[model samples]
Target: MNRILMLLFMCMPVMLWAQRLPVHEKQKELQERMVEVSLSEIQERLSLTEMQISQLRPVYKQYQKKVARLNMQNHKLFNRMNADTLSDEQAKTILREYLDRERKLYALNKQYMDNLLEILSPQQVIKLYQSDSDIKRKIRMEYLRRTGKPKR
Candidate 1:
């Protein structure tokens, strides 16, 4: 009985870790799909040449990675704010970190736009931004429709 109990204990971590693998894989796949869709939308909107698509792909991927990192950092900080016993100093520190992340995000956006402009005309860049907004709005509308909820 003791040996069986010991074996279960030894297997527990592996079992839990295995269970998490699929979730991580699905998240990664979803992220990749979103990127592909966004890239396709950009191509369609801008009528990008094959050469331009090749140039834009790497720059866009890098920007996405940087933005994802900042977003994850901000999410952690935001979670820390929900702690029941958070002191004022802790709250202030989180606020400062959050603001720093926001500044970094702003700078990253500027840098991304500059990179985009190098490969695209100003009007194309503007259309790219508009496409993003439209995609987001459509996603939100779909979510609301699926959830059977009215828009707030």
Candidate 2:
């Protein structure tokens, strides 16, 4: 009984820490699920063969993950800037970093676009991009609705 109690005590902190994780982490998980749903919807719309589906999902999953990561970084940078007033020097530095991050994200997106071309036909690629844009727009709208945000 002592050993069991000791084990429980040792695990308690980890459990509490997990529960205390920032809302951002939970929001990230929710966003990831939305991405999955968006991707699956795209997949359903595509006329992919079995082999193509197998090849496409993983590459696209990476694309989705990288986009999400870059967006999170972009948001973090803006949030950090907003969290405090900054000197001209500090603001200029953060602006440069933001620009650099945007360039990196553009490059990442271009790389994935090229990668997708290697796996899919031009027509299919066009369809995929269109579907992704549509799904993301719908997801944004749904999120706004759920949060009771007024749409512009």
Candidate 3:
């Protein structure tokens, strides 16, 4: 009885952790797939050489990870703002954090562009940016269409 209860307590955390492992792995796999798709689009739009693609892959992956982290932070801040009992100071703090994340995102974009310039022509870099925006817009439109939501 007592020993069985103790064993169950000991195994509970391990069981919970094992359950979480697949979810974490799935998230990682999705992120990798998104990065691959983005890279392929950029490569095709820029008409990148093999050498250029090799150079861009690492820089782009790091950029994507940092951007994802900052965006997650911003999403958390937005969720915090939705709390019904939020106070003025709390609201101000969340606003500041949100703006800080935005600035960091901008800095990340600038650094990514600087790195791209080293491997690509200015025109190619410009087209890459435009193509990225178009891709995002298309994704958003598709989401809206599937959800039957009107454009804001």
| Full-model lDDT, candidate 3 | 0.88
Residue 3 lDDT (model 1): 100
- Candidate 1 vs candidate 3: which has greater TM-score? 1
| Winning candidate number (TM-score) | 1
Clashing residue pairs in candidate 2 (N, C-alpha, C atoms within 3 angstroms): none
| Regions of model 1 farther than 4 Å from truth | 1-14, 80-84, 143-152
Estimate the TM-score of every prediction: 0.81, 0.77, 0.76
Q: Which parts of model 3 have CA positions greater than 4 angstroms off?
A: 1-18, 81-83, 137-152
Residue range 7-115, candidate 1, lDDT tens digits: 9999999999999999999988977777788888889888999999999999988898798889999887776556568898987888898898999999999999999
Q: Flag the better candidate by TM-score, 2 or 3.
A: 2
| Tens digit per residue, CA lDDT, model 2, 2-86 | 9999999999999888887876698879877886787678778987777877788789888888887888888988885563678
Pairs clashing within candidate 3:
none
Question: Which regions in candidate 2 have their CA more than 4 angstroms from the true location?
Answer: 1-18, 22-29, 82-84
Write one digit per residue (lDDT tens) for candidate 3, span 1-152.
Answer: 99999999999999999999999999899779878888898899888989999999999899889998998888877865565678988878888888988999999999999999999899988898898788778777987999999999
Ranking by TM-score: 1, 2, 3
